[model samples]
Target: MHRGFFGLLALGLTFAVPAAAADNLKITGDETVVTIETDDGVVDITRQKTEAALIGGVLQPMVPVPGVTPVGELEVLDALKTKSAKVVDMRTLEWRTKSTIPGSIHIPYTEVAMRLNELGCSGSQGAWDCANADKMIAFCNGPACPQSPTAIKAMAREGYPPEKIFYYRGGMQDWVVLGLTVAEDMF
Candidate 1:
């Protein structure tokens, strides 16, 4: 029994290590940076790790809403590349003016629900009908920032379909640390 158990454990580790390596997003090596063209200009997106402060404000929950899917850099990038969903910057204009994901749109947490029509929903400010809302990926400052979470929760409460929402919890913090493309002038 013990020998069989040890054998299984070794096999599991063997597979696990390779899988982990394949999925590793760690920033290393001298040639790891990448670049992408944006509306503003060509920007370098790096996988080079930095010691800069990347997170601030109050931390938010992992899953902001029960049915909303949480995503990371790769997922967010794929969506932007494919144009499969709208990437929204939930931070206020002040925060957005500093820097933001290249292709994302602005919709402050305070105004998201009131502006549901922009996401394909209809009705009015108080009466939202979001049955036909578009697929959206929401993000803000960073893990500690509550803007995205606040916007996501409000969106859910306002009857926006949770299944259609994707939360990028790392927000701008992770985006910058990872050396991803950011648009400085969002106006």
Candidate 2:
């Protein structure tokens, strides 16, 4: 092997570290460890075990966008119950047809920036005044999915306050895994 490859291995760069605030998203006693028998030996792989893994997609970092608060199931529920926040499902229509978090509004990532008015921002698409933008929680298929992250960045670029944005990185994968409420008729 090349010396650089050995150096990379020695640096222990196998997995990406999830950003902080992940504790709020973990379900009780969730086990992420996986055991596999390799040709050379037995391997125990831990981390990168979100439900997104089962569905087959690249595992995303716990924090997609810096300065955005990352939240979980409980936080999502509380926010919905209190009517203190708007939970947005940033997936495309096809994905959303399967299932979604209850009370979350559908706002495909492709159109979020143009739809800021629906979020309480005034003015037109290019000249938005988001001073009154609502506090929003954005999510998609799972941490592996980029829809919400894309929407989030667009919102931020359009002057949506990062403080008013919360990211539910676990998304539908974690929500379904936890057996929380799912909304099937959300078009």
Candidate 3:
């Protein structure tokens, strides 16, 4: 009788130990580590969630564009050929180094404010030579990326006409997906 009781207790502990360890792995708002038992093998899941942006007392991810329609790849390419538009590649340094659209200018989001003058827009004269010379389209990584919108806002604040600014939300990812040619050298 005593031996049978001990054997049952040992069997219960074998299953309970793994359950407790699985529960211990979870950490909220930081990194969640979970052990999943599968038919084939055990799998571990670790995910780190990003913080949300606050807007009007509601938390949300930063949107790339508010209410503007993103121009198509063909449209942008045609504009480039006609000299009717210019593209400002707002991708990060690491991303830009990998690949970029041909003839696109490099203006990382963080540097847009300081480099506004380089766009050939004369702040002193209150004229946007680059933007006015042709439509100005800004792009970064992709639709989920927030850099391009920030760049557009910076340009607008610097007196680049809003009407002339077109946000290319599709960005470099879309450009490459469409099999567009990427320039190895920076413009």
In order of listing, the candidates' clash counts read 2, 0, 0
* Higher-lDDT candidate of 2 and 3: 2
Q: Using TM-score as the measure, which candidate wins?
A: 2
In model 3, the runs with Cα more than 4 Å from the true position are 1-69, 124-134, 185-187
lDDT of 3 at 123: 52
Q: TM-score of predicted model 2?
A: 0.71
Distance (Å) between predicted and true CA of 125, model 1? 2.3
Computed on alpha carbons, the lDDT of every model, listed in order, comes to 0.80, 0.79, 0.63
For model 2 the local lDDT of residue 22 reads 35
Q: Model 2, range 1-187, lDDT digits (tens) per residue?
A: 5556346656775535445333223222343444578554666554534434424444566666678899998899999999899999999998888898878898999999899998889987778999998999999988667788888989889888888999998998888878788989679
Q: 68 in model 3: Cα distance from truth in Å?
A: 5.5
Give the worst 10-residue stretch by lDDT in candidate 1: 14-23
Tens-place lDDT digits, model 1, residues 144-175: 67788888888888899999999998889889
- Reference-based lDDT, residue 142, model 1: 78
Error of 3 at 114 (Å): 2.2
